[model samples]
Target chain A: MADTLNPPGQVPVTVLTGYLGAGKTTLLNRILSENHGRKYAVVINEFGELGVDNDLVVDTDEEVFEMNNGCICCTVRGDLIRIVNGLMKRRDKFDGIIIETTGLANPAPVAQTFFVDDTVKEKTRLDAIITVVDAKHLPQRLIDSAEAEEQIAFADVIVLNKVDLVSPDELAEVEAQIRRINKYAKIHHATKGNVSITELLDQGAFDLNRVLVHAPDFLTSDEHEHNDEIRSMSFEAEQPIDAERFNAWIGALLAEKGGDMLRTKGILSYEGDDRRFAFQAVHMMADGDFIGPWKDGEKRVSRIVFIGRNLNRPQLRRGFESCQVA
Target chain B: MSETADKVLQTRGKTRELDAFVVKASFDRSGSACAFALGDGEVAILRQGADDWQRIRAHEGAVLALATDAAPQGWISGGDDGRFYRIQPDGTVALIAPFGMRWVENVTSFTDGARTRLVACSAGKKLAVFNAQDEELKVFEHPSTVTGMVFDGKGKRVAASHYDGASVWLVASRSDTPRRLEWKGSHIGITMSPDGDNVVTSMQENSLHGWRLSDNQHMRMTGYPSKTQALSFTRSGKWLASSGADSVVLWPFFGGGPMGKPPTELAGGDGINCTYVACHPKDDLVAAGFADGLVVIADIASARILPVAGPGRGPISTLAWSPDGAHLALGSESGFAAMVDLSKK
Candidate 1:
């Protein structure tokens, strides 16, 4: 990730994506009219075109511009590039660009804009990709729609908005689905956009360092085979991971067949002492973190998750628990 | 809980972004024990005790294993570089032996026990033994990754637990076969009672096992809500404490006899799992680190938690008391190793 100099000059792109009826626009209105002074140039593909009632969540301005292209991932991606490029040309005209995508856009292609495209990425960096999901409908969406799947898959941050209507069990299901799609994204539950908008913008999200640290277990390179039911599970134990056995076990597990591992993250704790150890893994890469000393009254626990289609829970559980002093 | 923490350590040379290099490994004490292994088959040791600690080039290639022997002043280290070294009191690291292996991960030194022994295990099944003098005494092969190894009381027998299974191998004497204690499935933790009569282990099988070494019988402790990791025994070996799911469980060790139900229990922080448990070497006081960074010390007798705060908010990884049992040394995932002296701090 490139460093920002003028920082304010760096364009902020807000991605609104989530399962249907996720109150994304309700949240967007708050971002647009919030007491903040920063000037924002809004980009919405289906903003007014969708014909949803404006009565529910009011828009900041009727100065809405629609994209002729389809979803943000396909046609509007280039259009987004051109629009952002043209806007940046004007001096201090717009401080940032906030784009709201249809609930179905796979953010990968949209995210690829900053990394792949040369011109638009250079002028305007991705600020935040926000996804709003229907708290009540998450379970059905996960069980039904592929678009709803991608909406969560590529979220920079997630807002599980409209918690007043959904039950705790439903919320848990929604969260589980979100975690299943993208485990690294930080999800904050909110009752509308009642949450603070300060955390929304200028967060420097397209920042890969923190995201990468969160997802040491993401295996992007290896493609999944036919089977898909096998989900990668994670287990964290606050016990001292016999360092020697852990390294060897992970190395061999990856060496023998990392392609099948899916992903794993472990915050490890050892016996006889109080410290937390963090470890993560993808197909070929594995790393660790000695976060610091464990807090007072804190238990030494290592939380590990392994995601994959054909994950052998029995085998993984055995290997994972074996990490301690045993 | 610091007003501010200075960057006491960093890489000698900057190569890439600081965030990506989040300092994965960290160890510190009033000793020269912190080290990193290089892929070039060598290792560099940095003394965390001294501020201006000089870097000591150790091993030929990627340093694989390191340990502070029973003597807190001296150190023993091994590496994939095929060389081992011993740091004497004079600040000199002398090459002690050669072990040509892919990599060695841990060095378990129990040289002070009645039958002194040093054991090291590598990435695969490579296991080697050494005398107190650092001589290679023996080598054996295992089927899976050998993750856990420890010397039972008096160091008469050496037991190594595996990722898939667990076993106890006798050291000092050569011809006797290792007494086998099998806990199939994802087995994570293992600990022996001070009397060397009972053993407690955490399993990935969603259960815990208590084995009586005297009779070779075992009892599976169940009803855990989730995965548990920490296990410890009282100095007298009468009380066995195992923390798991959401509480610290205490079961009497009657030479692996039937533990129909736990005799005592210590409740954990709400919603946070108790991950590790350390019984005071000489007392019934127990420490448990939780998932949310709550380190609660509980009384095994009263089942009341004493406020022996943990090291940091991060998951506490290791909690070691000084030989005198006055100071609690804590290690963490964030590269913070702290010594909380009961008398001083």
Candidate 2:
């Protein structure tokens, strides 16, 4: 019976995902070898990939299992649940945990595990989902593998590695393709995975309060050709939303189409309320809260983003518009 | 209740600060000594009236699992350093098996007749069984990593629970196949009744799954708010006490099993979860340790609870009753170890 009011401190967990030959091993080695002054217990699919050695390295079998609750999209990494539990027993030995998934891993199950397992949720926080992409081959990967597209769609930070191998124009094209699939991820250009450790760790990217931080060019209007079936759609409404209607509409939408929705996020200004509402979801599992009251004179605009496959822009727009307070 | 618990700790309890997370504590069969496996890779042994515990560095890493050795005088421990060891009462350690880099997740031992003793330890997907002569008898493989292992009452069979099911194998049989009890989810821990008629597992989900060996009948126990990490059966094998909910949930195992009856809840409703439970060796009493560091012993006949220790520091990680049912040894994750002499009460 951990005291809910004053629970123990949670260790941050970072999940590293990438395609084959994307220089993930390079980044992992840097994290482990550099004098960052942080002790991280790394959980990798195999040992000996990194040239640098760590004191606490654990091997995991990417064992995924469906939940018994009948939710088709609520699959979780069973191995992670076990490993995290074991690691927490030795919590004093490490500062953080880093999990490196296999190239073919579905990031959804790994992400969903932090939400579904009670022990994991209480002991560790999902810091961020960092996906490494090959700048020279991302365009081809997007076309050839659905996993590649899904990885981009679920990332909070995209490491655009191997920028030196591709032409300037080709790099811009690859960046645009990544943006089309995921507009919220912060894109970092690096060669040989030489990104700053600060940018990748402790991002708090999954925190509801950090959701919907729109960049200057985040809402840029574009009518680009479709290169992949997966894409991102964003919506903004100036009028305050009826909370009840919006809840009903979003509930029904997620229930029917959550399998197609990889990730969703929003910050809303509800009718007759001064506080801001933050919402996020992975498939059908949704979480939300009133983060805080609006700043002194800030504009109370509501914004939402959905990264998924086969999105119906017009139908979603209509459903959103109908929730506005009339 | 809090005042009474404090008085009990002050009058009848002897406390020790081990300066490490206490993983598991058990008493030897003769009730002469108790051993505690610690996170700092050491095993501490305290005899019945010893003023201080003797510490032995048994492994190079945290001792993940510990059990009283089948030999009447020592303890067996498994460590994250991938080694299994036997610790003598006099602070001597012996390496029993070396698993290189894989963790020795669990260990259990049982004595058969007068001379034959069996020791079993699981490392990942393989379970290695050794005999009294320290000879590797057999290696059992499971479909997935074995989370829990236990021997039946007769020590002729052992059940290993893993993902999806629990497999019961005859300890001495040469056959590769075992009697499988199939379920759908991950089974994290397992226990068997003394009568050997039931095999129960604590699932990764907040529930318990049990199977009657007679027909492989499934008895699903649901509605636990958290994962049931601890489960124990009374001496008569009539009730199964578990930790998961706010209370000590005791499921009746005598009247046609706990298949359709409601479990009796005790010493709870305070918004605190019970983390570990140990039943008295010869009585219907059960000692339950809470997540808030409270220990309460409940009487089954009168439905009364006597608080044995007050809440503080950290959650209780292990609890065990001495063979004579007169002493209770408990430890918390914050290194608090206490031996309570309940015989005087």
TM-score of chain B, per candidate?
A: 0.72, 0.98
Once fitted onto the true fold, the runs of candidate 2 whose alpha carbons sit more than 4 angstroms away are A1-8, A47-52, A207-211, A214-228, A237-247, A268-278, A289-302, A318-326
Stretches of candidate 1 off by over 4 Å are A1-326, B1-68, B75-101, B112-123, B225-227, B255-258, B310-312
Error of 2 at B260 (Å): 1.3
In the range B1-345, model 1's lDDT, one tens digit per residue, is: 221111111111111111110111223223434433332333333443443323355554334445555454555665534465665544467866564433344455665544544644433355677776667776656555454466677777766655444667776666646677876544545677777776666654456776777777777888776555557777877777776667777777655334675546676546666666677767877766665445556777787764444334455444554444554444332223334435432
Interface Cα root-mean-square deviation for all models:
25.1, 1.5
* lDDT, residue B76, model 2: 90
Q: Scoring only chain A, what TM-score does candidate 1 earn?
A: 0.59
Cα lDDT tens digits, model 1, A205-285, are 533335545665534324333465435444544456888888888888877765455445556665655655556544434
- Tell me, by DockQ, which candidate is best: 2
Tell me the TM-score of model 1: 0.44
- Across B119-176, the per-residue lDDT of candidate 2 in tens digits comes to 8999888888999977899899998888999999888999999888899999889897
- Cα lDDT over the full model 2: 0.85
